[model samples]
Target: MRRDDPIPLVVDLDGTLLRSDLLLESALAYTRAQPLRLLAPLAWLAGGKAHLKQRLAQAAEIDVTTLPYDQRVLDLIGRERAAGRRIVLATASHQLYAERIAAHLQLFDEVLATENGVNLSAERKRDRLLQQYGQRGYDYAGNSNDDLPVWAAARHAYVVSAGGRLQRRAAALGNVAAVMAPVAPLQQLRTMLRAMRVHQWVKNVLIFLPLLAAHAANQPTRVLAGVLAFICFSLCASSVYLLNDLLDLPDDRRHKSKRKRPFAAGQLSLGIGMALAPLLLLAAFGLALWLLPWRFSAVLLAYYAITLGYSLYLKRLMALDAITLAALYTLRLIAGAAAFAVPLTFWLLAFSMFIFLSLALVKRYAELREARRRGETAQASGRGYFPGDLEMISSLGAASGYLSVLVLALYTQDRATVALYSRPQLIWLACPLLLFWVTRTWMLTHRGQMHDDPVVFALKDRASLLVGLLFALIFWGAS
Candidate 1:
């Protein structure tokens, strides 16, 4: 080829052509599909990263259509292709996934990727391109420091989604053709907050339930303990939530709203998320052990254990998953009672179990309902329910909800109710209001208007908020 001929454009797949890492993507997919065999991926890694990538690619294929591609990179590739410049897809990702992406985009004239025993990344990638294109015969597009070597060998470097430091480094190579705009710090902060799910910390407020139920508002020490418990629980819960998101990447990518989640949307790096999860958990446990009672710390450990189990295996069990979710919610209440040394009565436990169970089923029912609307006939992703199970789920959920109301009614008739309230009869009014709210919740879920998480829905719903205020008012008046 003549030196005057336009240099070939070679694009890196992970973090370059695509906004996400395919190796991490495949690993997450494999784990989600076969969580019980998690060691399988690790075992492959023991051989080499190339073996790990190849094994995961063969074990669980990612949906190329759902991958978050950098639109700017695609546009650049398109413009280059239209100019009759050859475009190549080169990467450290396994050949299996790379081929699928190349075929999906249909823009790459050639594909160079890791195969056999070789992990074609960094220097390996540079060597391969050098051998194929000769020195300065190709332009490369990449992101991250890993691409620094490849950029040095290329005639012109193109950076994608890179920060200022990376741009400066590439410029020192003295051949940067273009630099795509980076994500803003504020936007990145928002994405990180979303990934950590700070909003969901509201659920940790359940640690205060015993404080309210015991009418211990006048006791500062108990109240302070509850606040600390809430913070500890929030930190631990966020840790679990991040791990769940990491493991559920493939399923989340296929989900309607979940696809926008940080990990699934490529807004957060998998490595950073993986590191952050355990650090957060450690911080939580450190706080719990240092500040809370021993029993509270033990209860927090149980919560973590159960949540890990649910994320690992229990979530796949039919009917059992919802029951376990209810149990988890009940555990929060129990933990609260433990935190403040409050008595956890049978009435409170009974009411919590039934109500949380109902909400759990509501979550499942909503997922199945969405699957039906999406024309899916198979079981919902990472769930045991099929769309056809909607009717039964609704029936069972409504029954559990009503059972909670029955528990509340029975509690009002108890001698303890008389001891705690000036007019125990007024406590009976809460039963009907709860009935209305629970029934309305199920109705909205049935009509496909509810969020996937019922708790989140309740937090945002105006009607639910009003009912909560009224319930608080009634209880305070009785006290």
Candidate 2:
């Protein structure tokens, strides 16, 4: 095409130029920052879609630099602009976000976006483009069903990150200029699974500790109840994980590995995640009320409430966050006891709190170590600790771990231990093993080889696994 004959290349914002939706992004940010004002969005929606967008735009601020942009689309836009094409950013997203994105890229010659009471989308977008470029006089780049009407009216279609069916449909419209391949189904599935954090269900297995400790593991009825409780806690835990990710978006984006998370990376829409989290939580409580005893359900509710509180506010408090995390882990044990109507003794609870607190501190130490490795000297993002506090964290964590071993040793002298184990002295071997494992974990953290999640590290490490196996054998022989 000649320089004088270049058609304006109009690009859609959400899912076209960007991999995420601004409306959902803004809404989620608003909900997270002002949870009590949640109904404000619905009230705005009652006015109109444009009004809703305007209100949310005023309330929420997105870090444009962190937004995931389709690299291929950026390259295409760059090439078109270099060839003197007049690039137009025409998005249904409110003008507030659209203008910011346009300003960031500096590629859009003109920006046409929703403002005032009219949501500029679909046929509305098509009409506006026609008014400026005339019918079939402009090229449009878009990536969803909402863009089909605009594509039909455009001179050419540029499909960005659209599935095969969408590309075929766009082709049938007779103006397929180009198609950017979508992410593979298997890859998307993997991302979604990671987002849901199925692997973290390992933590919920702590719900069986009370049954095992009380020697009720062999009872079929108690075992069944414990397993059901485990499921409920797993679901509830997943919901909290999702919420944490949503709230930690900015900090996660700044982190090395967390930036790849579904919500933070823009692989999953914030709207879908916001909707799915509540459903998972509801399903968890439903199982609790239907199958578990009232006490168990109450414990589960308390666990959820405490965890939700941790995610919202407590997580920022340095030592308090670690202590709260330990309590959360101990609550799983309490939940199990409640579920199976088993007695949770003071010794077991004390041992668990100390051990889990150590692990929680290990998680923080690893985070600070990573920050230091990356040359970060200020306070860690979304955390109260600084890199300079790593030494103290290590000291406290190691001390906490040893205290748990001491608790275990003290438990051996209890009358209950003597009654439960014919050869209670064999349990002494487990303490040394526990000590070695804890020492090794702290050493790994010091060496910067530890994962930010100590439990995940334990699960993945061969040495930790062997130590755990030895403990199981020692306990089994004593029993």
Candidate 3:
């Protein structure tokens, strides 16, 4: 009963009242204030939008309270409420942040943010608003061009100062109105990069594991197909990651370290993810279809569906969680075989599963270990594995590595073996090195020193690095 129009006042936080420009300002201030080691990465991220929204969300949560909110704007909210209107604070910022801002204003009856845990970005904000207010008629106020879609989506549009390019283009639209916020290009760029999360693309390299061991060494066509497969897979994976992050933004903001993720941090917006996700998917499958045809296109589609399920339902399950993750990795190998039209052997299938299962278990152990060490409440996402249980997982990981070695050795000697290893004699050298690598890696993992990702760790750890080199050299020299 605070807003004058009882028509339901839909007010956006970032641009309409709290100067939206403050986000970029905060980002710049943060970069300059921090040590170069930290600031440099953020600034570099700014050059691209890979992690922009996340960084901004984080900055907002950390510094929004400290920054001086406009007294006039605060007074307007207070006075507007006193006028007996149905006031509401609408924003694409994290719900936590939005709620805090709403509470501080105390003029609104209800606050509409992203999912209570999900960071509300532009599109999400629009979606929620529409779900409540309807698409044909509702007054919408926002700061950036990203807000235009949502505004144009409304019955009437109120543009804040930060809406430069968007306002110019949308001014002619019947419902558009105008307001003020500062605008800076470089600062926005920095925020955008942090939101995109480019570093995560490295995970896509897993798609190449099958090629590393298979017989594609001499064939350029197969090699090219493999690369294309990984690239498409990476794009799809990242798209799903973005969707997952968008969906989990709320919980992530609650978590200690995960809060630093782009969406949770406020640098990215839900609208951006919604807008970008389809484009990314199209590109992923477009390449999948162009390079590999229907068979592979189906695998890529399946990967997407499986991962989307993981994001929504499977990830929270305990043991099943790791199994799904391991299967997903195995699928990458399967996809590679299909892409190259190469024959897959029993050893390759079994080896990939066993290795990934152990690796997934190790990831669970690391997560649980972190939780236990911190004395925090942690639940296994759906993997049937617990954060506090590492001993069994460690043993299992060790067994998996050794078993992989055993399988590969037997595969070399198996009557059905098509490889030229000659009675498992040459392949035997790979055994101890694998044992050394797996054991050492697990030893470090148990000690709580191994990085969260085993694949990434293999790239960095000196011993595993050496093991990988030895495996490649031995395999090639024998050939």
Candidate 4:
């Protein structure tokens, strides 16, 4: 080590001083946070490390409260800090979270982590380290060859684990100290699968199908009630999603895609997610009451019953599994109407089936497309589709498009709808336009741009916006 007083100690965040990467843990924390990117590892196999890193980084997210860290490791850091060494916890992890860990540990004299939107990696860490403490001489600890550039640049190095690939890389470097810890076991497979976000049941908010269909029909109170009902359902649904993610943390780790989730990746602990779940449920139920004080709690109960069943066994059955989900979605629309004490027309129910069936098919298509693209067999695991069925998906999508339009035509022609509209004839124009819009929406999905969540997509897509605005204008004008 170079001669200098008050040495600076640098530490890596993931697989170093800390137990696991918090970013991965949180990103995979949701039951539906998994959208795509299972194919990125295939890219890795094709020697697209940089591309894989880029894709994985997009998937990276962290909820600090949920992150896991051994108390013993924290104590080690605390004692080191008491010794008056200038301790720095540095890593390629996002700076916001790295700083959070540093603050929680409260032992680091300085955090040499990524900050100002820069990651501490290779030359980046080296440059900052050299510029900041080169004249002072410092000790740095890390765990990968990726850490080599900075380790070689440091005055002294603590090479933790000198036997793995990282150890071989450290062999050529002088000033290396040998200290290796036993590897922590991988997260449980079942827990990891839950983390993969296969069942994002809460986004079923679009189930306000009946109310939206009769939006302009002089049923403002009823429409508002139904909308509020769906929103209530959404909050409750999200609470369930959080709980499922917590429960499935163990299973999620077995799959390549699921291992990156918060619990499975060892970033977030099961306890925190579990603790957070009930609080969310409380808030959700409270919101439900505020939205629909007229006894909408029953809907929440039903949702829970059906979803818990789906999570336990329905999800594992091939064709019936996804169909169960479709039924659940349709049920939400029905429940919304029932919550508002509004009766639905046959057309309204049929429209719900058409739209949801299309969405279900599209979801399957996206997942299968992702599987094929990634060379993963997961889509075929308890799934009914194969790569050769893309054309069938398009056909099914077209049928749904036509059926959705037909449902709307029947709805508009109905006496209730005709009475609701101020200019009922102008409303007919909306049918073909809506049909085109629906087809276009699915086309975008087919092109791989369908954001995983359709409701969010409707809110985000410009075309969906225009179509919606036109519908609103005609409906309001007619009323």
Per-prediction TM-score to the true structure, in the order listed: 0.95, 0.95, 0.66, 0.54
**Given candidate 3, what's the lDDT at residue 73?**
56
Order by TM-score, highest first: 2, 1, 3, 4
C-alpha lDDT values of all predictions:
0.90, 0.89, 0.67, 0.64
Per-residue lDDT over 333-410 for candidate 4, one digit per residue giving the tens place of the 0 to 100 score: 667766666566787668777876777777767666766677664435434567666678768866876788888777
**Model 3 residue 102 lDDT?**
67
Number of the candidate with higher lDDT, 2 or 4: 2
Scored by Cα lDDT, where does model 3 land?
A: 0.67
Candidate 1 residue lDDT tens string, 1-479: 34345689999999888888888778777777787798888778999989988888899878899888888899988888887889999999999999999999999999999998899999999999999998998999999898999999999999888999989999999999888978898998888778999999998888888878888878999989988999899989989999999987778899999999998888887877888899999999999899988999899999999998898778988999999999999989999998999998899899989999999999999888888998999988888888999999999999999999999999988998899888888888899999999999998998889874899889899999999999999888888
**Model 2: what TM-score?**
0.95
Per-model C-alpha RMSD: 2.1, 1.7, 12.8, 15.7
lDDT of 3 by residue, 1-479 (tens): 32346456577777466643334433533433342344554564654442454455555334444333545456655655677756678765555566666676567778876542444656877787788878754666666667767777786676665546666766766776545444366765565555555555676665565566564667887778878887888778778777776655445655556777655555454456667777888999998988775777888888889987777667777667778888888888778777877677788889888888888877777877877787765564323555557777778777877887787777767755445543346667888887777787788888989654787777767777788788878777665
TM-score of 4: 0.54
